[model samples]
Target chain A: SQTIHQWPATLVQPVGSPLSLECTVEGTSNPNLYWYRQAAGRGLQLLFYSVGIGQISSEVPQNLSASRPQDRQFILSSKKLLLSDSGFYLCAWSVLGGLETQYFGPGTRLLVL
Target chain B: AQTVTQSQPEMSVQEAETVTLSCTYDTSENNYYLFWYKQPPSRQMILVIRQEAYKQQNATENRFSVNFQKAAKSFSLKISDSQLGDTAMYFCALASGTYKYIFGTGTRLKVLA
Candidate 1:
């Protein structure tokens, strides 16, 4: 079975600090990767997605950016974090060209103070 | 452009009962996909059900089912014999000619024992 993993299950960052969240999928090849954010009691906002290595399509323009350094490894980064950048960060994956279902990781909770 | 709407902000149901969560979407594309995702207190996004715009038959998974009205652009999730484990925030999403999904504001469901 395929599984998605994310690092730093919980994070606390000060304002204006750097941010890096990692996501990787095991047991799948050529999978589509995505990054999403959800504020408390709010819906998810798509930040970025990658169809392949070194190819990323951003959905929202904000303080975050994404990069696919490897086939199954995706990274979401921010040079300087903002107070509004705090939320639940989710990483998801699906089969290449498979839009029917998306598998998500455990997620990272970032609290900016 | 695509948009998903979930009017219910919160709901509660007793265990062993049936509950339906409503979802509506707007899109110009004829061929697309709709999905329902569950986010538990753990904050992991889990795929509950999926429906293809071209499919007329409703999709069912165990105690979970969907009433997919393609022409009406409505997809509702029905949870039968609901259990306490079903307590979570449910999100409706749409994907149309895009690499990412557009999500609706979540409906928090609490299945009481």
Candidate 2:
């Protein structure tokens, strides 16, 4: 079965600090990866998505950026985090072709103080 | 670009009763997909049900089912015999061939004991 793993399940970062969240998927190869953020009591906001290694697409312009360093490894990073960057970040993976079902990771909750 | 809309911001239902959450979407693509994702208190995004644009039959998973009206661009979720465990933030999402997903603002459903 396919599974996604994300780390620093919970994070507390000071304002103006850097940020890095990692997501890795197992049991699948060449999967499309996505990054999403959700505010309190709000729906998900797509930040970035990648179709393959070194290929990334930004859905919204924000303080965050995404990179696909490997086939199943995706990373969300920021050089300078803002207070508005605080939220629950989710990483999802889906198979190529016609499959639209996305499997999400446990997620990382970041609080920028 | 596609957009999803969840008309109900919040909904409540007595346990063992049925509740329907409304979702509408706008898209110009012929082939696409719609999904209902449940985010429990644990904050994990779980796939409840999925409907393909080409299929006329609605998708069902145990107590969860969808009423997919392609022409009307409406996909509503009906939860039968709701339980407290069903309380969560439900998101309606639309995905086209672009490999990107557009999500609604989401609806919070609470099942009263």
- Candidate 1: which stretches are off by over 4 Å? none
The worst-scoring run of ten residues by lDDT in candidate 1 chain B lies at B93-102
Evaluate every candidate with DockQ and list the scores.
Answer: 0.78, 0.66
Poorest 10 consecutive residues of model 2 chain A by lDDT? A94-103
Question: Model 2: residues >4 Å from true position, as ranges?
Answer: none
The lDDT, on a scale of 0 to 1, for candidate 2 is 0.93
For each candidate, what is the lDDT? 0.92, 0.93
How do the predictions measure up, each by TM-score?
0.97, 0.96
- lDDT of candidate 1 over B71-103, digit per residue (tens): 788999999999999999999999888777989
The DockQ-based CAPRI class assigned to model 2 is: medium
Give the top-scoring candidate (DockQ).
1
